[model samples]
Target chain A: MQNAEKKCAVKKCAMEKSSVTEKVFMSLTGLFLCLFLVVHLGGNLLLFKQDGGAAFNAYSHFMETSWIIRVIEIFLLLFFLTHIFMAIKLTIKNKQARPVSYAVNKASENSSWFSRNMEITGGVIFIFLCVHLYNFMFSQRFFHHYPSMYAAVRTVFQNPWYVLFYVICLSWVGFHLIHGVQSSFQSLGLRHPIFTPWIKKLGVLFAALIFLGFLSLPVYFFFSRTSRRNVQSAISHQLKIENGFKRGASQ
Target chain B: MKFTLKVWRQKNAQEQGSFVTYEVFGISEDMSFLEMLDVLNEDLTLKGEEPVAFAHDCREGICGTCGLFINGRAHGPLTGTTTCQLHIRHFKDGETITIEPWRAKAFPVIKDLVVDRSAFDRILQAGGFVSVNVGSAPEANGILVPKKNADEAFDTAACIGCGACVAACKNASAILFVSAKVSHLSLLPQGKPERRTRVLNMVKTMDEEGFGNCTNTGACEVECPKGITLASIARLRREYCKAKIKG
Candidate 1:
């Protein structure tokens, strides 16, 4: 009996450790992803150089070939997966915590809509990530579908549907970051009277910068002359393929 | 004045609950929220209907006994004030006020507005204390404490364990309450001896009580009657991390 009691105590302690440890992992990985976003936005800014994708393509090439970046890419993938897994797990537990909800919850009175709807924002961002990775990362790394990374991005942005989706997703990213950034610091136990308020303001600023910085690329490319030319050429290219197939079938 | 009260009525934990509406009249703006309820109950008693079962004691708001989710806001539409202290002036005449008990898995409804808050007591029993020898009272100034630490500790210690934080949170998390206890004790020299074990054990018990994790929404801080801040939660995390690392 005493041995069983001791075993129970050990299990309880382990459970306690994991609960806190899970939050720590969530915070650390989230902060790392935030850092990755800064670097990504910095590199993508090369698209605005007006050199018709030369600077951006060169930057992409370097990003693809660098061994350090390759290593960081693996860690980044791991962190992203861990973050999603922990988020889902914690969300499930949180839902279960409140089996009975209030009949009339004026939640807006106390918390922001974005703060309360993190799961919705996060889920939207995750969906966007899958589409984004397929469009750019996977295509560039393995498929080599276009002449250059910038060409691929420009082609994708030429589609009004894709551009609209991209803009919406980036806005969700902003929403996620607005809450996630400072919340990460709090989870990591870094709070100060003077600095915390500053951190909160900085979090909002960082989110806005990321939102606008990434937003400018898609909006710019969608309306740019190059993208329109690319779209017309793509349409003609499709016509040529169809016409050739028709002649071959007729023969 | 007249008002319509939509109050949550639950017979017991085993029963399903729903909102019951009652029309209350002759309510003055000067009457406290609980006093308004008292008038309603008096009317209900005179009418031979069962009076609304709500918890209240030490109506001065110190005992943390009275709690109501009034009109969707915890402890009514006031900031840093308990339900007992909230007056009818905040509401307009003929307005419909919604009142419900704190909702959480760990805090099941015992009756109408009373929840079983023994879960808090259990968590407190886990480690919300310091050990001292059973003898004559020790000198208060024997241990030196920084003024800032004392003030912070006092601020956090103001948490009355009313479960308002839990009610206000979207996830019904108890982190604010637990962190308040953890921060209040851990900040003082008297609470230093078993600081590590205290945090670990209290957190363990807290999780076992089925409370949710803190998502840092700041709702609890805003809804807290005692005005406990989220900084205590940060301090709790700091102490928790330090304890775990040291172990």
Candidate 2:
């Protein structure tokens, strides 16, 4: 089967090609988005306490108003888009490659389970982001204009079906974040012998904390009461003011 | 430690392959993985059975010839190590091990353990190198590169042309392998002369060779015996972009 398939002199030069730079791009984009997730989780946790919706809304509003954050957010969005697009392209290309592996294929047994599941996890999270934007961003930014942001917030999550949808999104986001955080380091060349163990543990700790914070919101909303005190408590607890604001903010 | 080996045996490239089971007694833990296989091969020869065919060279682990798929992982259970260098101590007595070869579309089995890695050579021919002038070699100090960039490029250069990345990948992508080669030359002055043509030609070659695209699943880096990063692939994208823009 040794047909004479020859490439050009320079083209066949194996001395120069390796994937270092592309790994860096993948790492930077993936890590930056993880930072975005942390900030997002911080705001999402506020949804758990009383006045949570209004509080979360105010936090969202604050993020929108900052020029620096606005710029960063745009970049963050771009990072998400680029990462997804690259992932799709790369995956497709790999799929079209050779079929049967060599008898002595090494390295396939030693990889981690999480790293292997990136495609499944990434796809899940991508779907979650789209649904999240539809429920919170699209409705609030584009739909019926209510004078109070709190009213819009309460109206969305108060519905049992919507609350359930948000819950599912939060869980999948958590799954994606766990694998994403560590894989980013692998891409960036951070897998040094001594630090690898510590870094992996650190990633797990961080992912768990962030996931719990984000997951609390939908859980809190499910058990909400319509009492005026409920609304007041939500707003006061979420905004972090002591009692007596008494503004009706029910779950 | 002695262990039970379940190795795939194929009569030829076109013939059907099957797992041939054997038990090796009193194996030394310190012996390299290949040494243990050697002992077993000796046993097979005396028994009048065909000795197992496995690929290995530079038992020091750098030539990229050893391609054992052990226990479902590439290069056995060790992280960042080739089979020839992997110690037998990683296995326990009576443990059953499964051995196979590099599996991919472009790589076909030539014998028992060896596959046609010439696809990589083919890919390289497609434009993996920089075409510099045939004049006298440049003086050692002619090109001054930042120490950091040099170090970084060297890290990518560590890839041993082993097809582990291809085997570990679910999609049989050679992105990590190709990226390592691409990034090494792209970073240095010696590689600059043909940078534009290099990217364009190599990418076209990669597509033509039937290697799959990178999905960023990151299995390649995890399974690499050299710990080659996926970042090299990112640099490939940038190079591709620059090439596209220039064209």
Candidate 3:
């Protein structure tokens, strides 16, 4: 039998692929998602306008109708899927590289807790996405006469459990973003002594903004609904006492 | 000072390893970490037991041959120092220091606290040199080199090929080591001719050697004996991207 030839040869050698291929993919897709978050936040913030759901409903309707937005949404979904896939692949590969674990791993000292637990934070965000899609996208796709986007959001946030869940998930998103934004730049070979510090600072600020912005929606809805209910009950109680006193006086 | 040590012992690559504890007495606080080990080995030799095998070429820090995972840190608790340069003074008396081999699939344990680092050599072989022909030495100022470039290249060239970076890395990635080589050569004019090919082949070899990918955690920079910065890895990425685009 003839001996097998080397798979890579001088004549048209298959390009040398590094394990960092997945890392690069994850970084780019992750940054794309970050941009998507900013656009998403801008749209979601319309729920706060008190103009009754008209503006938010109109915005949601426009987003649904525009072909360009539909295309962008598809790209957004693709980026999310790719980022998740690459993250899992790289994580598993990294684990296998060190089979026999360190006897006494002081790994936490070497890096930040968030940087080390990116996979856990990512997993939390993934679970949040599933619930979010089910609540919002499911209504948009399935219900022919769907409620206004504002009503749908308010209804979801009215549940204390759901609001709490959202707050928790948004916190994890902040954790993931804090490390991920700077990490993407590092992975992309854009590190510079002068600019890296600024980039890191900017990354932290950006993550904080996302956390606070998203958390505000659920928190605001929850508190506003509860306060309105409280005011209504107090007014009704006062009316009951007045009605009772008037009936007694007449008798 | 008296201290206890828990050193990892494996007869060969095929066997599983475990820690073996030993006690040493009357060691001076000023003795280097390796000297303490030598004292322990001497005692074991006198007792007719096989001496613990470890790697150390230059007792001073520069040779990069010596490496140990002391007390969970790569080159002991002291930052920016090699195992050979780490003094017993940094360690307290009666403390039990755990010494282990560089634990990575790419760096298999050869024998007690020693790992086969030939994977590094193979990576170097793949593309760690300039293509200049051997002949009479070129004139000192034949080629004008920018001072800033020369300084940066020198800083990058200081990487001693110690596997501490791999040991310290969460992923056991060799990106730092390969990046050092790539940055040092690509910055110089003599290495300009084959910079693209050099990065391609070296990275390819690094991947093939069963080393993991860098996650940019920056542990390698913190644990590096030579204080090699993460900038080299950044340059490696830039070089790789440029090469891929050119291709």
Best by lDDT: 1
How much is A156 displaced in model 1, in angstroms?
0.5
Candidate fnat values, all: 0.69, 0.38, 0.61
DockQ of 2: 0.22
What docking grade does candidate 2 earn? incorrect
- Per-prediction DockQ, in order? 0.59, 0.22, 0.55
Tens digits of per-residue lDDT, candidate 1, B1-247, equal: 9999999988998999899999999999999999999999999999998888999999998989999999889999999999999999999999999999999999999999989999999999999989788999888889899999999999999999999999999988898999999999999999987787788888888889998888889999999999999999888888888877666
Stretches of candidate 3 off by over 4 Å are: A1-16, A143-146
**How does candidate 2 score on lDDT?**
0.73
- Measured by TM-score, the strongest candidate is 3
- Each model's lDDT: 0.91, 0.73, 0.88
Q: lDDT, candidate 2, residue A182? A: 66
Alpha-carbon shift of residue A68 in model 2 (angstroms): 19
lDDT of 2 by residue, A1-251 (tens): 22223234433433333333344566688888888888877776666557646776677777657799878878988998878887776566555575554444333344455655667777877887887777666666678365445566566667778777767766666666666776667655455657766777887877777767766665555565455558887887877653334454532
Better of 1 and 2 by DockQ: 1
Which stretch of 10 consecutive residues in model 3 chain A shows the poorest summed lDDT? A2-11
**Residue A32 displacement in candidate 3 (angstroms):** 0.7
Candidate 2 residue spans exceeding 4 A from truth: A1-114, A126-165, A178-216, A226-251, B130-155, B215-219
- What are the per-residue Cα lDDT tens digits for candidate 3 across A21-106? 56778889999999989999999899899899899899998997899998998999899999998888788888888888778767
Tens-digit lDDT string for candidate 1 (A138-245):
997899999899999988998899999999999999999999899999998899989999999999999999999999999998888566688999999999999999
Per-residue lDDT tens digits for candidate 2, residues B40-148, read 9999999999999988889998999998888878887777999998998888878988888777768877777678888888878866676666889878788799998
